[model samples]
Target: MPATPVADPFDALDPVARRATPRVRIAVGAAVVLFIAAVAIAALVSSAATGGGAQGTIVAGGGAPATDLGVAAASDGGASGSPRVATPPLLVHVLGAVTRPGLVELAAGARVVDAVAAAGGFTAEADPAGVNLARPVVDGEQLMVLAVGQAPPPATGGAGASSGATADGTVHLNTADVAALDTLPRIGPALAQRIIDWREANGPFTSIDQLLEVAGIGDTVFSGLADKVAP
Candidate 1:
């Protein structure tokens, strides 16, 4: 046709444009990879800066650890687990011939000696022979210590000679001790002591019939003791 369009040698030799396109695509891909790497590195650094996943951590008053504080609390609770029990006290009435007389509180199972001590012991005129200090005391019982050289209390009735004598005719209500008084008909140690207590509280009996005035004594008791008792 017009000499085959006169073949262009320059066009056939030029591969510069095609090579340049491949280089540009490669550069863009490398840039994208660098940006992703930078973002990943920054995330990792932030995670390391702060406490990430640790658990069960405590901060005490002085920044003590959780384990230390927990152990201390457990120790305290264990030490106070059981409480102590207290014992009950005894109330006693101590009167007559003591430095300080009235009610006194003492430990349980206390003896008369303990009661006397609680009442400030005995006074100068206290006659220890009148009481059994070694004996144990009961809650509501009264204790009385007689004065030294004190005579038996007077009887309620007018004075009379000894009446209800024992087999030896020597027993007397005012002068008899607990043992001698216990020998009286229907009279026991307790009643004898009661009689002594009554005599000490009131005066000695003036007549055998005055025994009726003492506690635990009635007409029958008086009749039994009528011939044996005296003022």
Candidate 2:
């Protein structure tokens, strides 16, 4: 018997099935599109993650906390503050009618009374009336307190009120008592006292020229006494 050709039954029912395996081809095309879309979405997600990580690393490395800097600065400020230096003490020679007479350490601007107090106060023979207790004592000064009716030494600075004339008739500016200072023809008792006060308050006279610096001594008085005095 001769073989006859068979008709495809799916082509009659579905027009879209015109090509061989048309349904299968359509399904494969849709799957390929979906895979490409998924790949693209994954690429975008990876790029986003990489960019975010790099940005975080940069921020962490570059930005230091402000609080840490402030703390460091405050600590440095405390260490750099100024330091305090102690004041140097004064050295005075306390002498005469004080209970203990010797070198006494005192604060600056110490007065005679303070010096006396440091020297164990006055002795029974300390003629407080003879000394100017309120006067400010200087360094290396000899402070002497006389007994009642006791005469002051020739060159002594503290508590000496009388002027003494030298045997040679020349008065020493640093050593002469008030009496010797008054021996000048133009100088009197008041002027003599002024000279002693000046000598005591100021340091010893370095030169006879310093006589003019005395309160009562003018150029004329100094010139007259100049020839009669020595340093």
Top TM-score: which candidate number?
2
* Clash number by candidate, in order: 13, 6
Tell me the TM-score of model 1. Answer: 0.34
Any idea what lDDT model 1 has? 0.69
- Residue 186, candidate 1: Cα error in Å is 11
lDDT of 1 by residue, 89-160 (tens): 888767678999999998978988999999999999988877767666656555556678764332222221
- Please report how far candidate 1 places residue 136 from its true position, in Å: 0.3
The per-prediction CA RMSD against the true structure, in angstroms, equals 17.8, 15.4
lDDT, candidate 2, at 209: 87
RMSD of 2: 15.4
Cα deviation at 192, candidate 2, in Å, is 7.7
lDDT of 2 by residue, 1-231 (tens): 887868767648665556657678889999999999999999989989887445422224444354365564476564334754566766666666889989888887888789889999999987787656666665655566666666554533333322334555667777654445655768754576677788878988898888788887788877788777888
- Provide TM-scores for the models: 0.34, 0.42
